[model samples]
Target chain A: MSDTGLNPDMVSSGGASAAPPLSRIQGVDKVFSNGTVALKNLNLDIGRHEFLSLLGPSGCGKSTALRLLAGLGEPSRGEIRWEGGAPATGSATDKGHRDIGFVFQEPTLMPWATVFGNVYLPLKLSGVSKAESVIPVGEALEMVGLTGFEKAYPRELSGGMKMRVSIARALVTRPKLLLMDEPFAALDEITRFKLNNDLLELWRQQNWTVVFVTHSVFESVYLSNRIVVMAARPGRVYEELEVDAPYPRGEDFRTSADYASHCRRASDALHGAINA
Target chain B: MTMSRPDDDEFIPLPGLTPAQKRERIARLVLPGLILGFAVLAWEIGVTVNEVPHYILPAPSLIAETLIKDWGTLYGSLLVTLQITFSALIVATLGGAGLAILFTQSKWVEISFFPFAVILQVTPVIAIAPLILIYVDTVQVALLICAWIVAFFPILSNTTLGLNSADHNLRNLFELYGATRWQTLLHLRLPAAMPYFLGGLKIAGGLSLIGAIVAEFAAGSAGSGSGLAYRILESGYRLNIPRMFAALFMISITGILIFMSFSLLNHVLLRRWHESAIKREN
Candidate 1:
């Protein structure tokens, strides 16, 4: 893998290590100037190829956590470390030097750009020559099942197609860590289910770490290897659940008895957090 | 509940055409065309029946005859008016886009300069035309400057709004990709601003013609070269009403020409990309 330089296996496995932790959040606190606490004393360790989700209700700061990780906002106190180092400072270019992909609740595809052009954006920013970028862009578009939509502008696409374009855009960079903030919340149920399954397939194939933020308990249960349930009003983690389901989880798994068990547990945890 | 088979596989054809659709298509053409034809007929009849004299109100046929007779002179003046309008439009587009970029970059500059732009938009160009003629030294330069001032503000205002109106979610998506400010402006803001800028261009196109005529009126009276406005003024003073009507008809035709040119440009630029450009097939 091109990312072997930052191999997570080297750090934890007692092997000769070239690099360190892929991402580390320690003692992070976020308080606005207006004195509203968003995240409190947060600590998280995300290794390469892990699928972790921050599951919470509205105002629980799941999106805020994602923003902090993306370096869109700074932690009020403490630090976010990428590759076992402090967040980069100075110019926005310098800040968060690590390659990070983000998808918002909305598709956020550029209305002016065709699907291919939108996918080509990060590559263009990295100064990848157009010829060099074509294959990777094509592969990413194919991965998202948007193969023939290369020339279709965002306005011409339906909501699902737009979101697929957004996903393709994020994947074009092949970033080590993908941060998605409630990306499927706006989708209809069937589209949401299809996207969820497609996303997991992509995750398994790429083996990239994903930090997904979502308000849906079923979503977090379905897609995450681990779910971190957050409480509202000063957003703190209320519970952590490790989903023991095997890899390459299929649509069949969604209807299995185990899926219901996980959902029930998550719902209980959420209720407990709200009450507490 | 069983998951409804994804509508993804369904290809719903466009709705069937009905009597209503036919009626709508016919009405769209007939309503505007009929109203125009009726108005022209009334004007022709009123002038002939009331014996309003050709000088007072030349019939449409006489106007057409005058147009045919004076086609060469009128055509020359029309080209001059077009030159002023198009030149002013180009200058306004470049100037407006440049200032909008600057304003987007700095809040202080926007706050300071925006009010001055508003003042220019509201202030009468006729009031300033003589002053511009006196200071500009050349008649063409004076006319260009006057038209530019009149046409510049809409583009600036519309473009700035469009640039700033990028969706917050899209802005975040760009930031997440670590796009530089310049990259964001070029790839995101500028493309997003196209519709608004083009809208402003349409409005400015008409204003440019009006401004050129107004400026020429003030300039010709101040002893500048003879433009269409001067011909109209001179013909009216000499009680040459047919010639004055002819000049008025030429000016209206000039306005229509300016409008058609811009409408064409809008269609060409936006046809494949925008709903506003799409003509209904039905």
Candidate 2:
């Protein structure tokens, strides 16, 4: 993907809101040292408690945008403002971690640690003693349906179970903002669907603002309230589509005409992005 | 629905070995033993049939006899060699790993001193033993320095690689979680480097033993307080081939024991996670 047409109006395109966003990406550009413009003039506003999906094909800077939101790296030109100006840095930098929990494309677990230990990591880093962390860690594991496997190592668990552990680890910190970069992309469909249901349940219950990045049209439509279709070559937003579906979306929703229409809309937008 | 969990209880000290794995483990021991038994038997028969002189080519039986007969003198030499080998290995472990940690903490330090470490490792310990002995007043200290140089590099290089090779994603996670530098080193880097450090320890164990013997030979320190190497040298000069073989046997046994212990340590430390230690069904 190469940078070509610069859409001036695309800057903060769909970010107009009454209440302040959980985080705002304004005129952000990420140009790597190798001179590949991963993102150019990208804009998005992650609202509180909204399941927003950054949908795009590969090289569309979807992950880059998510990382930028996480404060993983500085945007080449613009700025990402978390709620209340810049993030406060004490012990936890409030960057990619502190008030934010990030799940990468891979499970990214510490193989040597047990499931409990892996989940306990964020708490542990924040200076919570193991004794103090037991409740939160257990709750996280319980949420991910991995309570019984706390003693298990990553290698001993199946791929799906390992990913559950990763999810549990992300949830243990109980961050208001959860940034997932195609967390279920590597999973089989059955497991992915199960995790999607579980994740949606957790998001609804906890009221977390989740910015999920994925290319799967069906997954984006099924799990997200808002899907931002992004085009490649200096990744920029192409379209913002909303799924006005209610809570507790399950197998019925997955098979419904509503879900199909949403998927169709997202699929067409993605095709447009790929061809553009 | 619950996750598809493994049926076997994971915390079992020894996971129930599959029949194939059991058979493989048995063969690992029995096969080597069988071959060694036949070889020893052949040697015994060949010596008797040829009527070879004991001084030139002692039979296995004669070597065993010599080992038992010279137990007092040989045992003392064995202790001396053991002392030096273990001392060198312990010192090398601490020094090498400490230096590796230091090197990893600062790129400038590594760049400045890594070449010197390489020089010490590549140059033969035997070639430098005479100079060490001449410069150092204490023969034991000189031998230790020589053996230490021989055994130090593996731990240094392997640990450096291990510390640096911690999973990048995990490093990012640690940074994300605001893990302190000490916490990262202790929790992430140390555990990740364990298998590598154990691997280096195994190699250094054998190398230290070899270094001790080679350095002793170069020193040519005989009489009382001498190691097994001097005993072998003394036996050779006196044409006591059986005694020489007996000392050689002890050295071989010690080396095997060192390797086996380190292997056991590696297995115990990494059985739960590392691919090298885990027993796969496929």
Candidate 3:
């Protein structure tokens, strides 16, 4: 299902009516108690099944924006709408079992659980019996190419395998929106490249709305349909770049002229934001 | 890069060939046994040469003879001491784990109660044994309580620290998964605490033995039903030095047994995945 030789907006055309926006943020602002303004009057629309990346420098509050959307933290001001309506008002803690999934920068696999047990956790929390959870857990493991590692403990797995388990855990719940916070930041370059390809494949198959947070310009350009660049020290949107690269873009695309130009543009934008 | 063959993972190497391999491997036994045998030989020789009084450092042979001759009385007292130690150990495990869970749940409870736990740990069991005897009615129960007090804190402190020491990232993952507080405690926190709890248990195992013996000393209960502590005292008073040595030997053996049992348990639970369990060849 590669969107080869296609405009960025082409992916949004046919499903525009059927798959409504999964999230809408309108003029959201976040200020900390220490007199630090983290986000300033940000407005964005996240469409269903679109892999949107928030790219910026280290303290640009990309993580904060993701946190706000995940309902882990409240926006200091303005509205966040989910599924065409304003997000329910209250503390994020009050959201009582939301169906959102999050993968952190670190693998964050539970040390005490086996690979299978970690993937099965959300279902177990939802009161699914062990017998019923087996099929879904196996399928998730299979998706991540960790079929035989079910009984292996987290400590027994390599760093990449651990992250794969973490990904499997997030995917097992079948969430509509998947939020990732620099999940591959700790992996080696080669592993990160492979995982990025696998992630895009999973995105194509599952069609979940994704909001990825990253500090790397190249990663954002390669993976996102649109990149929302933010500036640091009272973060606000500096610019939004739509990546016109076709879907299922492979290693060869990384060597192409288009990829280099996109990376250069993103890099210059980031540099300008930082210098300013 | 090619991965190592899966069969290589299952390989267990033997050091050498022939009975000598078995002898060399089991030769660890020889050193300790030789030392013990030499010590016994020296004792018997000293008794013969110096014509030392039987009331003082009796020969190992004499001690063994006394142990065998008085097997009924010594056996009965051994049973009593074992009962007290095991009972106290059970109480400590339950009470320590329960208090640890409580401390993990409430910050205020931890702050208020943790110092008291420290105080209990540092205070000498000998100093409190008399007071505990005064308050508690039965000798057995008083001894058990004192032993529990001495043994309980390490497990409590270690397990509580372990529970709080869970990986911060993992805790966040649990929160993202919408796990309830109790579910997190049962599934994540408690299992993380196991190794620490086992560490504490190893320490507590020896302490329980010491506590039982010390409590018995403070209680000053003697005669047929008294524990091994009384046997040591009785033999000492009667100048049956060999029997006293035998009682001391039994106590040391009990301590080693406790250590071995806990080490075995630690191996059985964590050996499959933990580094501590994997034996390295040097």
Candidate 4:
């Protein structure tokens, strides 16, 4: 758990209770069809109930790593070993792994569906009827502070509200791991801050593992208990920083000297990774 | 701009139409009617003042009189033409959409059959109608085939494009959730394709009517169960120029009605979500 640990795949100190890692990416390499080396020898351990941010620049394969965790794509070289012997590699013939929820940078809602319908999608894919999903869907929306917007179409809502719906959809299934790829990057600063606070609050309450990919130092510092800075040109981990500050982090903590010091460290690591 | 209180978020009612919007709404209805009224009046005046013989160029009044005077025969023929048009449209919808789904399911199938669809689309229905009439046993079935041939291509092409156009992120989301292929098709692809399919339907509706009339002209089967086009042909032969104008008028009205009805259907289906159908604040 020490910062000076030599293993790049070491689990963060946030899960200090000695629970085994939820998943492990062991020597994963991703080479696209055009021979673009997206990831090179990537190794990381996702601790249970920990907010781990994969902070890096564009082309750093942070998103590629997230997608692999969600089984959206296969690693070209190595395997992701999940808990209890489940592997995260996708196969078209098998019923896909449903233990992961994902949020894209864009809201990515079904434009033709109502808010409830969009949020109910994961359960529906699992064969839960609409009549059966009302309570869980309502609860998910309420968790995101969007209860009254269940009937509104995505077009009628503001961008912030649409992203809220996207979050609600991701949370509805109550998945074990939530993978978010810069979900607030497209939003305004005020909205981004508000959502960041709400997301941290939700993560604390739900106790689900989250792997958030972002290029923003402040955002990574504010939300995550641990940050992994990754370098591009065949993306690999450069460094990991543990944000030792306590949680239930609020506006006061945001303005505190403690938060500034953590951001500065994360920013320095990020800059080093970018240069490397 | 007015500052809205945070508590008033639940029911931020849409503002009432401004004066300019009201004027625009009124002008939409009134302007078209006024121009049409003036044009008809001028035609009436020009015909009656010049004492032009009815055979050469029937006046508006004569055309209207002929419409009522021969409603029994004309109405029956109108029904016949409408039956062909609607029937062709329904069959075209089923066949075109079904084929498009099949095309999407397999690349090899699409590659094998798509060129035939393009060939059918590129060859003029008018040129093919005579050959179809020569082969098919019944003129009515031949007309239906021509109309269907004209209508189905747009639906197939548009629906294929729409199915392929589902958001890439959404598709990945569905895949992550372990959605079955059938579930993805039913929930995502079909609904996403609705607006495009409806656009194709609007175009097909009018084309079906045109195809029916053109096929009837080629058939020239004038004894009984003839459509409005046959009446048009018969009136022309007898020099009943006013009746010919009357029949032509019915065809125009029918075309307008088909286009308008399909357009209404499109708006109703997509008013809530689609950019083409939603009403923007500005």
Please provide, for model 2 over B1-282, each residue's C-alpha lDDT reduced to its tens digit, 9 standing for 90 to 100: 222332222333336778888899999999999999999999999999999999889999999999999999999999999999999999999999999999989999999999999999999888999899889888899889888999999999999999999998888788777678899999999999998999999999999999999989998943234799999999998999999999999999999999999999988899888889766555
Tell me model 1's lDDT, rounded to 2 decimals.
Answer: 0.78
DockQ metric for all predictions: 0.23, 0.39, 0.20, 0.40
TM-score for each prediction?
0.88, 0.94, 0.86, 0.93
Ranking by DockQ: 4, 2, 1, 3
Q: Which 10-residue window of candidate 2 chain B scores lowest in summed lDDT?
A: B1-10
User: What is the Å distance of residue A83 in model 2 from its true position?
Assistant: 1.6
Per-residue error for A61 in candidate 1, Å, reads: 1.1
What does candidate 3's lDDT look like per residue over B90-197, in tens digits?
A: 999999989999999999999999899899889998999888888877889999988998999988989998898888767766766667898889888988888899
The DockQ-based CAPRI class assigned to model 4 is acceptable
The DockQ leader among the candidates is 4
Clash pairs detected, candidate 2: none
The Cα local distance difference test for each model comes to 0.78, 0.84, 0.79, 0.86
User: Which should have the higher DockQ, number 3 or number 4?
Assistant: 4
Please write out the lDDT profile of model 3 over residues A170-207, one tens digit for every residue. 87777778899999999888778878878887887787
Give per-residue CA lDDT, model 4, range A1-276, as digits (tens).
454343444434434546888898888999999999999999888888999999999999999999988888899998888887663322322232256779999999999999999999888887777888898888888888887778888887778888888988888877778999999999888888888878887888888899999999999989988888888988988788888789989899889999999898888877787887
Which candidate, 1 or 4, would have the higher DockQ against the true structure? 4
Give the Å shift of residue A138 in candidate 2.
0.9
* TM-score (C-alpha, index-matched) for candidate 3: 0.86
Docking class of 3: incorrect
Candidate 2 positional error at B16, Å = 1.7
Task: Write candidate 1's Cα lDDT for B39-132 as tens digits.
Answer: 9999999998998978777898888888788878777776787788789988998999899989999999999999999998899999998888
